[model samples]
Every structure is written in structure tokens, then in C-alpha cells.
Target: MKTLALLSAAALTTTLLATPAHAAVTQWGACLPGQGVDPRQECTTIEVPMDYSAPGGPSVTLAVSRIKTARPEVRRGVLLIIPGGPGSPGLNRPSTLVKKLPQEVLDRYDIIGFDPRGVGKSSPVSCGLAPADLSLTRLKPYPDADGGIAENAAWSRRIAEACARNGGPLIRHISTRNHARDIDRIRAALGEEKISYWGVSYGTYAGAVHATMFPATTDRVVLDSNDDPDPRKVSRQWLANYAVGVEDSFPDFGVWAAARDSDYGLGADAAAVRKTFLDLAARLDREPLAWPGAKPEQLLTGNLLRETLLNALYSTANYPMLAGLMKAALNRAELPMPNQPEEAALQNTAAHAGATMCNDIEWPNSIARHEQQVKRNRAVYPLTAGMPVNLGPCAYWPFKPAEQATRISSRGPANVLLIQNLRDPSTPYSGALKMREAFGQRARMVAVDSGGHGVYLANGNACGDRTVTDFLVTGHLPARDRNC
Candidate 1:
């Protein structure tokens, strides 16, 4: 993790070319076709050079959108909604999430969203991976049968080779540092002196980079479900944290599974429910049940249940799906696989996710070390079945980290406020604490007594939402650390 800190510092000092100032404010009248957004929401295209340092080089067009502030008297500046996925397109978010914001917040800002480089309507990149390689179950980090990531290592190598052959030079520029510069370009295009933002999941990493690179231009930045910026470990650190996340969040699923025993016929007690899940996963490891429509020819029950459980942890609303899947498996009934979106859509999204994660940081190239860790992780965190700590495309990523990972410093303004859930399955509390410690007293943290990801307005308690909303609306934070 400390390795990441050094990398981030180095990245900050690296020279980035500046864009020429343009006075033209070209506003387009039409909305993006088929977005179903309100007519008042404006859509347009902004051309950015593919390589920022080479201003005369080939360029890419980033799609941008904004819903203007309804109240002119109280208008402040632009509120940028940075999307996650290293590959997620935020092009339509302003018309969606921004509309739900409190009027006071809306009045003070013009909500904006853009497709990050190599994603959505922005200039895209693809590895041209076969359909079999695009499965969610396959894309997820999972260890080999012998509790090793040798296969993952090979997969990573294959992906890197494919991307190199097909991704062109644009793949090299997808790093978060470059994305921060892209945001700055968007800010310049919008003609705003400074920008406020709400960044979720991987988007938080982008926001942090933006703030670090251009601290003076940031205002009211909200980083939700934050990622640890340790450049050495990077996404690997995130995958390993899932073990802690499952430990933190699985208990909630256990309680839910036990309470619904009468309906699901899974178990009469929470302990029994927990044991049943583990037992079933172990059993499936030996004799997997057949599942139609799933990738890899047939779905192993353990991996299927693991996939279901991970998706379920995203929100409480998906609990019943997990419960139903458990019931079907318990009854030895035929289980159906969930429908995947169109092939083109899946390929596009997977390519973007791969590019973003692989480009952000360099991964360890040691297969033996990954195998040792996965074995130890599976033995201790059986509920997660060692999938959380497994390797992905980064292990064999062709490029070294563009810059070392960013070491977060509390040297800036104390205006930053953190809102976290006690048991976030994706970004667990333990990881959040690291981020909190990194920020130090430069920021205040409000820990909500809740579960799931995205603390505010997504899966958080009222106390948590009020803390964040109050900060956003009034620019005041609690004088000290507070727990809800």
C-alpha cells in the first residue's frame, strides 16, 4: 500500500499538457437519442485530444450533458457527477440522480455528467475478447480449483496481449490521472472557475485524483464507497478487502435467510443457515448442478451461489433473489441462469472495466504469491470462498503503473466529509477506516449503523444522509467524529 503512495506522488509531478483556452460556448439543443431525459437537459460533444501531451495528435469526442440550475438567484457553480466503472458512462446521470437532489442543492449548481475516456459515447476501446470471456462469472476474480490464480495469471496475460493488439494508444491514456485532466477540460468547457462533485464507487478514485491534481479548482467534493489509493496494491487491495466485506455483510444475509426459513425452507436458525450455505458450496465443488444460459458451459453451484450472494449484497432489495436461489438449490430443482444483456453491451462494459482497472495501476506478476494468499484466504474466509482475494487482468497487465499510486494527504482544506456504512459489502468499514486515517483531521467521518454500499441516498440511514446533505447544503460538518 505504501508503494501506491510513492507512485501517486510521482504521478502528481509528471508534466501534463494544458488545453488552449477557448471563448466559444457552443450549446446543442437536442438530447441524446433514446435517453428519455427531459427536453430541458442539454446535450453536446466536446473534442479532446487522445493524447493530452500531443495537442496536435488524433482526438476523441467526450459526450457531455447538463441540466441547468432552475433557480438563477442562488446559482453557484457546476456540480459534476463522476460515474464509476473506470468504464461507466455518466452521460445520462445528470438527468437521473441529479433530479432527486434537494432543490437548495440543485439551485446552487448545474448538474453535469460525462462519459470518461474509453467508455460510453466517448472514444471506445476493446480487447475483442470472445463471448465466453465476457461472462460476469468469468470476469469476476476467482481462484483456480487448487486455490491458485495460475489461470488468472494466464487470463491476465491474454487480456493484455489482446488489448495491446486491439486497444491502440488510447488504452495507455485511460489512467485516473488522465481522467482528472479530462475533468479539468470539461470544467474549462463549461466555463466554471471551480466544480463541485458527487463521485461513487470507482468514481471516488477519479474525484480524489482530480482534487489532488487541481486542489484549487475543487469545491464540495463527495466521495462515496471510496477506493484505497495505495498504488502498489491498487485494485488487488480492493479485491482482498472483499473478504472483510463478506465477513461484515454476510451476517445481515444470514439474519435475513433465517427469518424467512418458513417461506424458503432453508433453515430454522441463523447458524444453521450459515452452515447450510457453506455445506452446499462445498458439495457443489464436487458435483455442480447444471444451469442453462450460464457461461462456462455449466454453472457450479458454489460459484453460482457465490455470484448470487455478491450481487445480493449490493442492496437489501435483492435479498429475496438470494433466498429463492438457495431454496431452489436446497430442493435439488433445476436452476435457471439470469439473462445477460445484449452481447455488444456486455463486451463494451467488460472492455471498459478491464481497461480502467488494468490501466490504473500495475499488478504483481507472481503466480506463486497469489496462490499462497488465495489458499490462506479460503481457509479463513470460507464464506467468500476465496473469490474476493483472487487475481484479475492486472496481474499480467502489460504496462507498468503510469505513475505511482496517490498517497492521500490531509494537507488541503478540511471541507471534505466522509459518510460510510458500518457493513458495506463492496467497500467494508475496515477499508473505510484506512481512508479516514489517511484523510486525518483534514476531514470528519460519519459512520452509519447500516449495511450495503453507497452510504447516502442509496442504502444509508437517515442520520447518515442528513449528515452528508447538511454538509453539501450548508458546508458545515460535525465538529468531531460521530457514529449513527
Candidate 2:
């Protein structure tokens, strides 16, 4: 869900184990059958006040899960796996994480994961968006062929209104601050005075806020694929960074395609590959292919090609998918089917993201302002083509932020470790630096010479993996910021 494209079917763009004492004690049970669930994961629920300010008000249940360390005697504490996406489903993260985590790290901590209040297995929210509004193009909408966003503006209003109409009180309550509070609640439920954390993407912001708000209750922290924690911009900054991120990451694809020109006739070199992609996108914009659910009238246009290009830069593994699709499009041959995720899941995540992003900070409500920004952005960054600043649901959200955005500070334990890829397509390195700056002396950064949305164990950066693992195993941080 890092790229809004990943879960933006229709443009909606889309745990832990712990046993503790008193209020934190959980009753674990078998998970209801679901995809990708690890059998070893035990599940349960925690009832939290829907509105933390009103503790006695109605409550919502969050599905929580955990995988206890078999080597309990050596267990140090609970390790919460904070997931990315304001809409990202995380109940199964513990299961997925167990496979990737080093044995020593697993032995030292009971891995925990949870579906935030409005995600899978937890209470979910949906805007009941019409099928038309749910198309993949809507997630990161492009301006009209002539650089207009009248339709994009319409989609924003429709989505924002739909969310307010269909979303219940819980949607209004799902803010990053609230998510941070929920994390604290989980910590209390686990009966831990301080919890260790490994947060990724948007999770890094939540974790940063958690460490900021409840610094006394946090132990070792690993923030991977960080977000800019500027209280003023918040999610708006995240949205804008997509343009910069794409610019930074697309070169990797260009070079890769150029090198493998024999397999895929994109171009013979980096410059040639870049020109080929730009030309193909422009050509498609002028002469679209038939696609059932693409935006700007059910046809594959240049914008969709650009969107696909942005999504493809997310991982090297996805390079072939984009390369092949481009080849097919260029040849006017059989194109691969657009990969559509389950619709209901898309709605849930879209609504979840809508609530969290809009509720995190106050967005400029003027559609004109958004259009103006988009126009300026489009001129400077052609790769993203103004999608970054395009009118989105946040511009018309139903409620104002319940509270101010959390400002991460240097006033915490020196336990936060940041690992970032210099060319992450989703969360750019420049934004990660802002996150590091926000944390100040409280965090140490390991700038890996790699590319992609995630780093540490994920990017196969041995130095990064070891640095993070060593920190988790023994509360030791590097004396100074280092490059891997």
C-alpha cells in the first residue's frame, strides 16, 4: 500500500502476541480462516475507547496477534511490528515477519501485530464508493488530457462526502495520534513498561509519534522506510513526495531495462530507455488502449501508463511486469491483465487511509488551491505528471483533525534507529532525512546505498540488517551516523 497504486483499486487507495497482567492480559484463540495467516499465530481482541478523549464512550475492538518466543527464558520483551499504510492490514504481519526475522531477534522478543481500528479483522470502515470512483486511476488521479482536474475534483468531493456519509464515528477517530495511543494501549495490555518497535513506511510516523508521546514507555526502536514527520504538512507532504520519489527511483528501472535490452527491447542504454518510456507514455496518452475500468473514460491512457510506471519502480521484481506491459502496449499486442486486488479489501483500505490522512492534519480545503499546486508540480516533475498534488479525498474530508499532528522531538531515549534506502520509490530518502531530523539526537540513521521502498532485512543490505539486528539484540547504537 506504500504506493497508493498498490491498493487503489478504483482510486481508493488503500499483531501481536503478548500476555500481560491486569488490563493487558489477553485471551488468545485460533484465528478465523484467512489468507496468509500463519497457523502459529494466536489471535485476540482489545477493546479501546473509540474516542480516547471520551474514555467512557463507545469502544471498538482491535484484532491483535502474537507469536511467543519458544525460547522464553531468553526473551527480553515484546517486539511490535508496526505496519505501513494508514490502510495496511497487519494482523498477519507477525506471521510474515517470523519468516524474515533473524532467530536471535525472534528468541529475544515475542513478535506482535494488529489490525489498526479500521483495518481487516478489526472494526472496518467503508465509504461505499460507487464502482466508478473505485478505479485504480482514482488512487493517484492525473489531471485531464489538457492539464485540468475538474473530474479529479469531482472524485475528491464524492469520496470525501461518501466517507462522511457512510463512515461512522470510528472513521472520525482513526488518526495517527489515535493510532499512537492505541499502540500505547497495546503496550499496557501486554503488561510491558516499555516495548521495542520496528515500524515501516507510514508505520515509522506512527512509531515516531508513539516514541514522542510515550517515550518513557518505548524501548529499542527501528524505523524503516521513514516518512517526513513535519506536523504542518503531514500526509500532504507524503503525497507530494511521491513525485520526488518516482524521480529518484525511475532511473534504477531505466538502467535495468537498458542493461537487459536483449530480453526486452525497451532501449539500449539508460538515456534511451528513459526516452522510450516517456515517448510510449505520451503516445498512449494520445492514443489509448482498451481497458475496462481505467479512469478518464474506461481506456488505458498515458496517465495510467505513468501510474503503472510509478508502481513498477517500487521493486526490481516488478520491473519485468512493467517492461512487458510497455512492450505489449508499444506493439499493440496482447497486454497482460491489470492486477486487481479484491474490491472489498480495496474499499476498506481506501476508507481507512482517507480517515487517517485527512484526520492527521488540516488540509487546504480549496479545490482551486489543489489544482494550482498540481499545475505547478506538473511543470517541474513530468514523471509523476502532477498526480502528487492532485486533488485527493483529503481536500474534502468530513471532519477536522481531532488533535494537532504529533511533533517528533529529540527528547526521547536514544533508542530509535532509522534504516533507509537512498532511492525508495514510496518514501524518498529526502523525506526520511526529515524524519531523522525530527527525531534529532534520539535517533541514529544507517543510510544504505540501495534502492526500494524498504530497507534493513528487506533490501538485502547485509550491513543495514546487521546494524539493526545488533541494536535490537543489545541496545547498542552506532556512535555516529554511518553509510552502508
Q: Tens digit of lDDT per residue, candidate 1, span 179-216?
A: 88888888888888878888887787788778778878
Worst 10 residues of 2 by lDDT: 9-18
How far residue 285's Cα lies from its native spot in candidate 1, in Å, is: 2.1
- Runs in model 1 deviating more than 4 A are 1-25, 295-300, 336-339
Overall lDDT per candidate, in order of appearance? 0.73, 0.84
Per-residue CA lDDT of model 2 for 11-97, tens digit only, reads 222121222212665479987766677888998888777888877667777778999998989999999988888788778888888
List the candidates' TM-scores in order. 0.91, 0.94
Question: Against the true structure, candidate 2 has what lDDT?
Answer: 0.84
Which residue runs of candidate 2 sit more than 4 Å off their true CA positions? Answer: 1-5, 8-22, 292-298
Candidate 1: residue pairs that collide: 4-231, 4-232, 7-404, 7-405, 8-404, 8-405, 8-406
In TM-score terms, which candidate is top? 2
